[model samples]
Target: MNTFRLSKRIMNINRTEIADLIYNKIIENRSAIKTQFLKTNETVGYFFMDDLLPTELALEIHAKFPTTEEAVKRKNIREFKFTAFQMNNYNSLLEEVIYAFQDERIIQLISEICNLEAVYGDENLYAGGLSLMGKDNFLNPHLDNSHDKDRKRWRVLNLLYYVTPNWTLENGGNLEIWPEGLKKKQTTIESKFNRLVVMTTHQKSWHSVSKVLKDDVRCCVSNYYFSDTPFLNSDTFHITTFRGRSSEKIKDIFLRIDNGLRSNMRRLFKKGVRENPHQYKK
Candidate 1:
């Protein structure tokens, strides 16, 4: 149980402002946005501090959060996850804030940021919750699968709202983006507190959570929005693959094998013969 002071920080753009920004950004620079994404060979784009929340309140939410090893092991990657835990809609303030996030304005903003057409949004908020990773916790590079419940729609964007006050690069738990493959070094994205990162999630968007090294927990609010169509015209099917960084050869081989097996099974039994229990149902 960690005890910390609570605080708040409001942003210049609230719900109304966010919607207007999205619409205007889309209408103004559609061609430039599309061209940038195509040339980068990356599925997503990022926007930061677009909307701000009360810092003290967010810290209080973090203070009250339960720290559980079992939960982290179940949801986190091993050999890393020294301290990682999460709670979903655990309080009214968080729920209210999350609910406000479902507005069309916010959704459109995300779509336009990624230069994609607005398709659909997930207000039900399944798997879209709070996640905390402390010293040593890490997520390996992987591709987010392409669909939502029952393969109904394509999951195009991953919105991460980080809120760890005074967090720094040396604290670890940075996000590594592998625009190229594992053979090439990755581009590291600092998970700055109060900063929101909206990235494209598709076959080529290989990313992972770096290992944390500080005593404080790096907290983040995770959300995913889906659309009726895919982000790429030449997108191919694949599983959520994982890979070790350039150094860990053995781990990389094992993970690749694991991904291959799961992918093969999915292809043989379209829609994955068994129901995926990770879905959020309302």
Candidate 2:
């Protein structure tokens, strides 16, 4: 099989090989990534690596991404995007890449760099998987739900891998980190093609994606790493909370109330009002 050739069906690429490539790249920039994360430890710790995968493989993945129309559309004030968690329904190669990050060695390396421990991967892809955003799609500044689907583990790190070739600054959908709370300035991380971003998820790690300025779809493969304990002693249970951008004052009020109500309900219900349908059933 010609590894460089593109086809209707992706050639079988071993996850171990993919993991090795990722490991090497992280190793290559270990100092910078580690320093970046450590310096921001008090706030939202993060670091990104460009050209995460080889150009050929990255383009192939982008070419195989299911269109926005084919995935789940989540349109509302809080966010507007499409997400796909059920990997069996997508290209086999997509599944391979998603699981490749879950490779034990990669997890350990990431854990070390972030000064975190016992970080484990989610096989079920709970709120973690393929997401695509086209024009006007935006994710508000928010904290991820504190725990995994079962509420047993604390979510510690977020992994985002971009495969959209030629994605640019003019293109919105870039990751925005509000390190000094939402009122202060925000740090924008371009969702550059073939880039992988890793960030610590704690109580103060508020982040969002800028609205897509172009008609093009910004594609990303996302995954989360959980730990046995919370990243900070102050971290506590909270649902996936979101707040409107500064311009939307009314929305900000509504969302805050909405968050409070949800938190109250969770206190009463414990597990939640019902099962969250976001996880991969298989």
Q: Which candidate should be chosen as best, given TM-score against the real structure?
A: 2
Judge candidate 1 at residue 30 and give its lDDT: 54
Residue 2 of model 2 has an lDDT of: 37
Q: What does candidate 2's lDDT look like per residue over 1-282, in tens digits? A: 234442323467767878988999999999999988889888999999898887888998888889987899999768999998888888988988999999999999999999988889999999998999999999999999999988999999999999898999889999999999999999999999999999989888999999999989999999999999999999989898999888889999999998999999999998899988788888
Clashing pairs in 2: none
Model 1 Cα RMSD, 1 decimal: 6.0
Report every candidate's CA lDDT.
0.63, 0.91
CA lDDT of 133 in candidate 2? 94
Candidate 1 at residue 96, lDDT? 42
Model 1 regions lying over 4 Å from their true place: 1-44, 69-72, 75-89, 124-127
